[model samples]
Target: MNTLKQGDAVPNFTAKDEQGNTISLSDYKGKKLVVFFYPKASTPGCTVEACNLRDNYEVLQDQGYELLGVSADSAKRQANFKNKYEFPFPLLADEDKTVINAFGVWGPKKFMGKEYEGIHRMTFLINEKGVVERVIEKVKTKDHAAQILA
Candidate 1:
């Protein structure tokens, strides 16, 4: 996977969120954003990461960051996960890999001694101008907010 790196410009794209609302990168112009990509919605690890963000949503916003979650799940599934967790952010339902591929997060993944192609759990911190300021590949699901804050 050709993962995006710090200092790179995040590709402009639009996709549907859990509410079937169209969201675009352009909408976040002039605002710092935290875009996190997870393997799936409602899964164990994914839940921790999302909940961590949700739990600290206010602090993150106070620090000038808007959060967004992305995954290759359908809108219905994403909605369920968000509703269940009461996440304070929007979760993009990237069923067609539009945002996933643009960020280069989909590639080979190994699990249970088997290898398969899947979405890599990653997060990108973008500055106000849309340039990636940080890329967190080794995400600490439970302490993700700390990682981002740090």
Candidate 2:
């Protein structure tokens, strides 16, 4: 996959969140945004990563960042995951891979010595102008917030 890198401009795409609410890239204009893409909802690794962010949500906002989570999960699944975790951020139910393809996170991946296509866990730090300032590919599931804020 031709993943988006630092200095790239994020596509102004619209998608539905776990609450089935329409969300768009333009909605976060004039504010720093954290767009994090995960493989699935409620998975072990994904859960840890998301919960880490949730636990540090206040610190993230204090630093002027709005968080958005994305996964190729159904709305119901996304809803359940968010509700269970009580995450303050919205989780995009990108079932069609629209946002995933736009961010170029869907590609080959390996797990347990097996290789296959999947959504790569990634986080993008975008500036107020919507241009990516940093791309964190080596995400630490338990210390993701530290990675982002670092």
Candidate 3:
């Protein structure tokens, strides 16, 4: 998969949400969308990142942005994470890695001197026209939302 550039048109995808609801990228057409891809759900880093987005949800909403999170986690796990955090956004369960691979976020990752294949933390900002406006590749979990907003 090629790394999507700022002007690239986002690939259309349909993914299952925590509630088993099918969500299609087209559903959010004509709206600014923030699609964040993380490695897993409920982990420390993921939790902080999700919470940060939740905390800044109002601000982002005011700016006319819709947020969605994507991970290879199961629907059950995503539900637990969403419910636990009271997340006001959809978390896509990409268990088949279809969305992750489509966005080029699934790749090798190194941790503790070891490397393994996983989802790289990334966020794509898509404009109202469905063209990517930015690709946030270097994410700092603690204040990710602020960084994205910046």
Q: In candidate 2, list every pair of residues with a backbone clash.
A: none
Tell me the tens digit of each residue's lDDT in model 2 across 1-150: 989999999989899999889999999999999999999899999999999999999999999999999999999999999999999999999999999999999999999999999999999999999999999998999999999999
Cα error, candidate 3, residue 67 (Å): 0.1
Model 3: per-residue Cα lDDT over 1-150, one tens digit each: 366779999889998999999999999989999999888899999999999999999999998999999999999999999999999999999999888877888777889999898888999999999899999999988898888788
The C-alpha local distance difference test score for the whole of candidate 2 amounts to 0.97
- Sort every candidate by lDDT, greatest first: 1, 2, 3
Give one digit per residue, the lDDT tens place, for model 1 in 1-102.
998899999999999999999999999999999999999898999999999999999999999999999999999999999999999899999999999999
Better model by TM-score, 1 or 3?
Answer: 1
- Per-candidate clashes, comma-separated: 0, 0, 0
Q: After superposition, how far is residue 108 of candidate 1 from its true place, in Å?
A: 0.2
Arrange candidates by TM-score, highest first: which order?
1, 2, 3
TM-score list, all predictions = 0.99, 0.98, 0.97
> Where is model 3 more than 4 Å wrong at Cα?
none
